[model samples]
Target: MKTVAICSGKGGVGKTALACSIAAIIAGDQKRVLLFDGNLGLPNCDVYCGIEVGCTLGHIVRDGRELRDAVVPTKAGFDLISGGSGWKELAQLEGAEIDALVGDLMVLADTYDHVLIDCAPGVGNRVFPFLRASQGLMVVTTSEAASLMDGYALLKNAWDVNPSLTAGLVVNHVGSPAQGRGVASEVQGIVGQFLSQELEYWGSIRHDSLVARACAERRIFASAFPTAGPSQDLVDAANAIMGLGVEAEATEEISMLGRIKSVFGKKTEDSEDKAA
Candidate 1:
């Protein structure tokens, strides 16, 4: 399976909605898609999908439930493994907890063509593991200055954790596609010039009232408004992600990329070595 982590630096960037939209779009193509809510303490992908849930990843970890049994199929054409709403243990997972989660995640992800991980909105320890484990990372940001800076911080820290990470940027809630592309280009060029890491402009979504309406109505935005501009933008993103051509690295080895250093987040001293 090709695991793709979707994250942002701060909250309220519509990352969750975009993740569900992308999942539905990919699943629409007849590919098996699994939308894993990696947000830990505050998981709510089900809310966006407008689906009822019972057992979740939290049950799998906390109560020893089977991974297969915990999976819930959504009306949006994909499966969802949600996270607990306010599990403090889940929020502060470490050591064995994280390892077992990653192990189970990979095992569950094995049954699907794609896994869209809706990670917690930050660069904390809990979020980096998913970033390191995934074959690709998608950072969501708005056009605001602070949002762009925080998004860049997340990218820099992500590369520091996993040097092999291939990243992409998605400009969300833009006034126009050109505006979003410009924002994506600016961030992409900055990362290339400083960190020397490639951040592809995956795609961008416009500020559509339908998106908000879908969220308020507890429905999948793209399915509820397929012809909307933002939905088409999400479709473009899904196609770009499908065409990314993820490398066939062993998942276990990929999970171990920053196992030792990421907890403390120690960086290599030589910047040149990093850029290499």
Candidate 2:
């Protein structure tokens, strides 16, 4: 499966909403898609898709529940693994524990065409494991200066951990397409110049009231308002992401164990840098 982690450095930038819409769009095309709400501290995938989640990853980790049992099918035609909200224990998971979780997830990888992880915003511990495991990392940001700064920070952190990590940028809530492109260009230019990293502009989502209304109704805006501007924007973004050919790998180059080791190794280096 092509694993993609959707993350942002700052919250309230409509990261989860974009993830749900993209997953729904792909699933609507009859592709088997698995959407995991990896925002362990504050997951809202269930709320966005209007599904009631009984068991979560927390049950699997803490209570020894089966991973497959925690996989809940949503009305959007995709399977969802809901993350635990207010579960501080999950936030404290060590590198080995995170690898164990990814190991369990790999069992279901062959069953789906795509696995979209809606990661929690920021450069926190919970974010890197998914980034390391994923073949593609899409960072969502708005036109605001703070959002762009933080988004670049997130990209830098991901690259620092795994230099081989492929990443893209998605500018959301833009007033115009040109505006979005400008924002993406600025961020991409900075990353390329300073970090020697290139960020592909996957696409952008337009600012529309329909998106807000759909979210308020606890439904995916793409499905609820298919013809809306924001909906079409999401469709275009999904198409761009698919064009990246993240699934074209002949073999898995990085195993779960490798991911864990890489992440932990980077953590140690980062701590040392701080101490220096």
What is the lDDT of every predicted structure here? 0.86, 0.86
After best superposition, candidate 2 residue 130: deviation in angstroms?
0.7
User: C-alpha displacement of 213 in model 2, angstroms?
Assistant: 1.0
* Model 1 agreement with the true structure over 163-189: per-residue lDDT tens digits: 887788999999998999999988988
Cα-based TM-score, every candidate: 0.87, 0.86
Candidate 2: pairs in clash = none
13-91: candidate 2 lDDT, tens digit per residue:
9999999999999999888999988887788798999888889887777887778888998888989998857776676
Q: Give me the displacement of residue 49 in model 1, in angstroms.
A: 0.8
- Assess candidate 1 and give its TM-score to the true structure: 0.87
In angstroms, the error of model 2 at 247 is 8.8
Clashing pairs in 1: none
